[model samples]
Target: MTRLQPLPGGLPERFHVAHAMEKGASRTRLRASDLSAPFHGVRSLSLGEADTILDRCRSYVPRLAPGQFFSHETVFVLRGLSTPEWPYVPRIHVSAHRPAREPRTHGVVGHRLQTREPAIDVGPEGMPIENAVRAWRQCGRLWGLDDLVAGADALLAGRHPIASLGDLEEEVALMGDVRGGILRRSLALARPGVRSPRETHLRLLLVRRGFPEPDVNVDIFSTRGEFVAEIDLAFAAWRVAVEYDGRVHAEDPRQFARDADRWAAIRDAGWDHVRILNHHLRGGGAPAVAMVRAALIRAGWRPGL
Candidate 1:
């Protein structure tokens, strides 16, 4: 028995089948078990690339038409935004504008949108996607108030920011009661400078309990003008700092030590520190809210003020 001829060396890991055929590849060689078809007429090397959402999107790029681009939570995942995973299940998203039909590919979900260029951002690798602001607006139709605000806060977050708070506000202002005004409502609750979605959840939990909105990622300073640390949420007037303590800090020895030192310094600076955990966020977040309220009271915050 004779072995099949290998594909041309110049071909990429993921390439159009027609392109590979045009590049001096025989039909039999292209049908081999080594390559997997991620989309019709597209083949990937079938490595670990299929394991992630971003890789799956890239694999489908060859099938993307001129009017179609990525949208919703798919673009969020592609761009590394912290969106809920539920929205991304079952099928990858493909989008187009008015008058043009959305994609109908297998393993793809089509979205007919009211968006075009300028609102569409072509990323570094040349993958066209809805800009972060427009995607946030589109997401309003899918996410609830908490997930919506959390996604926006991530875009406006000081670290790895995709857009500014002003960017979100501008998009929301133009939406004009779309999705029954959830865009505007989420914007009213969302804050800039939050570090993570967990921090956003903590802030919203406090505000929902009628606690005053705390500053997100506030910097602490000693009287000597030295920076202490950037606490997750801070009540500047009340001198209360609340932080979300995830498992990473507890499981990693070095990170745990640094967190300990940071918490100690905040206390030494005469501030009340509240540490919130995942359990506190469950069951309506009453426990975490109570903890923050106690810290506020310790710093002289009175009820009905």
Candidate 2:
């Protein structure tokens, strides 16, 4: 773990500026300005994360409109709020004070504050990024799920925890978004390394397409209390088990043998099974929804009025 250098006055050191000068100086001829104290009087704040934008704009302070606050996106990066897979966009939101201008041309964006909402104070530096991430969670309700997820990704990848981002994402996801689905919340509940990537994708697709959700990685056991098989996705009442089979399953000889044994064990326990391939779920073949729907119908899923 990289120990964060203790910041001066609890403010992030301008690491971005330092990184930029280092890069520019490395290229053949260095400028006179680069030799001088380019960061004179500029208290460089480290966002506690590394990035190209952070490197380029290290010397520049975000130009904010009079009373605008930092949006979830900027705060997310500054605070380290999300998983590494999440994409980070360099933008900040400022609340619209007077009549909003026609999208100001600054690098930072001015997002109108929700009516009657006061600005939330982002805490001091050197405090765990998690605290700022909590503030980002609150900001997401006014913004959207995409922003929130992006924010969470930035924070988490930068070494913050998912727990610190809080539960607002789950709450909003439950309420449904433009697509009238709850993917955000479902993703929040997904445990890393527990489910195969294929299984996780299928589960998300089912939820997105409005299928009856299945229990992920449910356990199966014999009447004699012996463990039978751990299903990838299971419906207990229907006795249906959906397994996501990846290409690796077909390629690896050892994995194939283990899978054969697992399948035999499952069959002996008298459970119905349906295997879906990753290509089928993710590619342009029979759509994931159709395949799942067919399986459910064959297993006697009644249509609701």
Candidate 3:
């Protein structure tokens, strides 16, 4: 038996078998028990547990052909968009130009395109990937209106946005019912400055219940014009704010202290603040909606006013 050579540095987590051969590993050693064969010609010594969808994707990189970009749910994971955990598909999604031949692999979803190639961008691994906006459009075929809105908000949020709402609108117009108009309604609901999917869900719940849509992540100023703090969802005119307290708030000590101080400042500024938890959303958001509604009413908001 030949002695196996050490792997070279700077290789990705998963690499082609040829790369190992270049590093002085014999084909026999490459098939040794220490290495795992993720794809036909790809081998890795440390293929971490394939628990999450992303963990599985790392194993499929070698099989991703040139001119093919990751799309659908795979792109959602790559872009860090919030999605449900269940319904995990082991198959990887690949998109390519017309005359696309679906790979013979059993666990891969191939999309052959007749229209002009969807816009392409590079992912974290420097591999060709579908741009965020185009990926969101592709996702419309699978996700519901609320989930799509959350995804759009994620794309358009933060200082360095992946894509603008205008960019998404343009893409939707170009698609024009190709996806059965799934993205059209979500486009209307999508807004900027939303920080998380839960926040988006809260906003959608309020609007669906006939409450005036609240502003997202707006800064509150004291009566003296000093900036108080930025609240998650606010009705500036009504001096009402709504916040979603996810597990991180209570689990992280630093965040817990910061949140306490921020809420105190908001209260000192004479604004009504409503804190929502995962439980509030679980029961169809009735408790949260009723709470926000009462606060809005007290602040002089009225229906059809």
Highest TM-score: give the candidate number. Answer: 1
Candidate 3 clashing pairs, residues 3+ apart or interchain = none
lDDT of candidate 3 over 132-161, digit per residue (tens): 788788787777778888889989899988
User: Which candidate has the highest lDDT of all?
Assistant: 1
lDDT of 1 by residue, 1-305 (tens): 66768788888788988888888887777778788888788888874548777778889888787788888877777777768634445247888998778988788889987654446788538899887788888787777878888998888876567888788888777765567788888888878788788888888878878888888888898767789998898899999989998877577899889878888988888789899999998878888988988888888898779
Worst 10 residues of 2 by lDDT: 27-36
**Whole-model lDDT, model 2:** 0.50
TM-score of 1: 0.88
Can you write out model 2's per-residue Cα lDDT over 133-181, one digit (the tens) per residue?
Answer: 3345445444444444444433333223444333544434443443333
Return the lDDT, model 2, position 237: 70
Ranking by TM-score: 1, 3, 2
Candidate-wise lDDT, in order: 0.81, 0.50, 0.80
Model 1, position 73: C-alpha lDDT score: 75
Q: TM-score, each model?
A: 0.88, 0.46, 0.86
Better of 2 and 3 by TM-score: 3
Q: Flag regions of model 3 displaced more than 4 Å.
A: 1-13, 17-31, 85-91, 115-118, 302-305
Q: Candidate 1's error at 244, in angstroms? A: 1.0
User: Which stretches in model 1 have alpha-carbon errors above 4 Å?
Assistant: 24-28, 47-49, 85-91, 98-101, 159-161
